[model samples]
Target: MQIQDLLKRTDKLPNVPDVVRELIQLLNDPNAKYSDIAARVSHDQTISLKVLRIVNSAYFGLARKISSIDEATVLLGMDRLKTLVIASGFASSVTKVDGIDLPEFWTESFRVAELSQWFAKRTESVDADEAFTIGIVHNIGRLLLHLTAPDVAHDIQTRVSNRQASRFKAEQDLLGFTSQDAGKALMDMWHFPKALGFAVQQHKRPFADGDPDPLACVLNLACYLNACIRTEREIDLVREGLPMAVIEAAGLSPSIVYELDDAMAVSDGLGHLIH
Candidate 1:
């Protein structure tokens, strides 16, 4: 299929609920007021219940229980709670990934989200909340492909595992586009921020256009480290850490990535917003 066709294939993608769409709109708004957001979320019972559940989940380890959106707002902060609401609200829409283990897929995605935010905080080059939200939703294209073309998607993943080659190449060979291409289309369909669309489109080649986007660079390095945590050997990780290009592009020290080898070795459910 051509890029135009992929961009227009809106009906083939997962159905994002209206609540999630509203949350996305709120998150993308720069001048959005906290009371407006709190009121919007309060009207949606599903989101309100899920938000309370996720915040109270042992993952956050809060000092006191949050019983209302107002309380959650004061405790988690508007920016942090906004991203959390997005994560929790948007998760149910993308759970049906073809040929991928659902639990393991979420586990890895959550790890990448945490690591992306962690890297962003350490670098201070981008908004950590945005990075976290981007990391979690970055691979919606893969889920789109799985839902749209199951057999072809499985074939590409098989080649990725067996040949240890880039999934991007495999996707291009078989489907005329990679997940990033699909991701861009999905981001556009969702009316997300332009930064998210740009990052998703070029995260793998963050420096392709001269100066790199700090957000994309962090996402690239975080995805790389997350993959290594899942698949590569520990000794190999210590001996050959993040490439110089990644460190320079993200303006982070090599030692930070190296030291993370032992620290972030396990996922341990650090990023699971939806249980």
Candidate 2:
């Protein structure tokens, strides 16, 4: 029931693509140029093609097609396009799990990621792309469980539904780890920058240490808002679930969150993911 037990279950982890690993390093480097990242992205034809497709597609709503990685870099900026590359490349690398619906999972991830970026930019609390990355990867542990421990994962989902148990509590009670634990272990395995890994670990209790990790807090709110959006709930329901520290950290009021309704919609963008 320890993290070690979960880690020992090899099927639970996503294979972080070489493309994603290199991009993470470049993003962490203060001196890394846009050209450098562009070059790295172009090294993987699948990712490069996927990014170009998304950029040129209606999702980005550009005036003209993005013909190459260089052009994509210029139009989308380094961070935003890089976030897309990472999301697409990582999605490409993960094999289909027996039970989880990857398309829905990815759609939700991207939705939350985009919302996180918008909110982060609003507050200037963290980099938009960093927030985006954290949001997309936050629930990765759920995938890990679906792959490596299907029965337990399904049972937890059932309990969360039938018994009104929360996902975290159900996971903790049945398997001795929450999705947060699995997320932390997965991100740690991928060797991302600390804040990205930390967000995965601390997002469920973003100010548990009495100080907010701005990105985690933003992601915390993003996940809540995503659920609200998916369920067609009112903004008040979302506000009720949000932590006060997260609201302060993101410089967001309930009114502002309410105002963000349109920007957070994902039905159009989910169509752009590579098949």
Candidate 3:
């Protein structure tokens, strides 16, 4: 089936809030004021409470607690405040879907997001917050597929697990499009930044073109690193196992992957925001 057909049956998917939609519009607006953003967030008590909860969480490691939306905006800065708002808002909208492990899914997504931000900071062309946001949303199409077609999703997963086909190949065979295709369609429907949608579409094959999109490259590396972490692979192996072209594409050194692995080790429990 086409991506549009699946999206047309999105009754089980999360309904993005109006405030979240407005916040997303402001996401790419260079002229957006922090005061206005704070006011908007404060107006939505649900999002406001979640933002405060996340900012005050141990993940941020702030010295003192923040009590107000204005203070949150000031402390987080516009970029990060925007990231938090988008993350919390989108995350809060998600309802339970069948045939998926919500906690496990979010845990991986959060790790990838943190790693994406880390890679973005080191890459000259990528925006760290944008990378983080994309990382969180990269797998949403898979979730959507699970919601709309659990039987097909299950078969695809089983095919990959049984070594019958790669996940992408299985998706292409079964659904006529990869999750990335569905994800980009969803992002377009949500009116997210075009670059963000492009990054999601290209992440699995960041170097498909002669010159890679830096955000896509960063996200690809983040997913790679996150996989290594999940499998508990040795740092030396991770460094050696990664392709030299992939490392260069993200403008990172092999040594930093070790550092990131150690950092990720201590970054547990941060995925609470997803629940």
Candidate 4:
């Protein structure tokens, strides 16, 4: 089925919270005050609790507890606060899909989000916080498919698992579009910046054309490094496994991946948010 058809199943597709939708709009507004953002987040009790829980968790290494959205905004800065609120909102919104391990999925997603932020900051290629937000939501398409068409999604995943086809190829052959396409559609539906939708759509082939989105390049590299990190690949293997073209496209030196690898080793605590 087409993405629009899947999206039309509003009863199946999870809805992003209203507050998160509003916060996303604030991301593009330069004049949005931190106080205003904090107040907006406070509007959702569930999201606010999750956001504060994540901020005060060991992942952030905060010395003092943040009891309120206002305190979190003041302590974490607007970008950091925005990232937490967005992450919390998205995570809390989605329901469990059959055949997918929700905890593991979220763990990897958060890992990628952190790694993407690191790459963005290290290479100065994109807005680091925006990179983080994109990373968190990048896999929404996979979840959406499972939610809307479980049998087809499972078949496609099985094909990839059995080495019959790559995930992207299986998705395109079976669904007529890749998860990236669905993700882009979802981003557009949610009114995210067009650039973010482009990044989601082209993350797998960020350099497929003459011009590549820097955010896509950052996300693509982060996914590679996330795989390496998860598999406990040595730094040498990680370096050798990276696509040199992607490295160059992201304007990252070969050595930077080493530093990133080290950083990810300690970021396992981020799972605390989802756990």
Task: State which candidate has the highest TM-score.
Answer: 4
Give the number of the best model, judged by lDDT.
4
* Model 1 steric clash pairs: none
| TM-score of model 2 vs. true structure | 0.89
- The number of clashing residue pairs in model 4 is 0
Candidate 3 similarity to native, TM-score: 0.91
Q: lDDT at 140 for candidate 3? A: 84
Show how many residue pairs clash in every candidate, following the order shown.
Answer: 0, 0, 0, 0
lDDT of each: 0.76, 0.77, 0.81, 0.83
Instruction: Give TM-scores for every candidate, taking all chains together and pairing residue i with residue i.
Output: 0.87, 0.89, 0.91, 0.94
lDDT of 1: 0.76
Query: Candidate 4 has what TM-score?
Result: 0.94
Predicted structure 3: lDDT: 0.81
lDDT (tens digit, per residue) of candidate 3 on 129-232? 78888888889889888887889999999999999999999999999999998889988998887998888989899877678877888889888888988999
Residue 10, candidate 4: Cα error in Å is 0.6
Where is model 3 more than 4 Å wrong at Cα? 61-65, 253-269
Which RMSD values do the candidates have, in order?
2.7, 2.4, 2.2, 1.7
Q: Please give the range of 10 consecutive residues that has the lowest summed lDDT in model 2.
A: 266-275
Ranking by lDDT: 4, 3, 2, 1
Model 1 C-alpha lDDT per residue in residues 148-185, reported as the tens digit of each score: 77888888989999996689889889888888878888
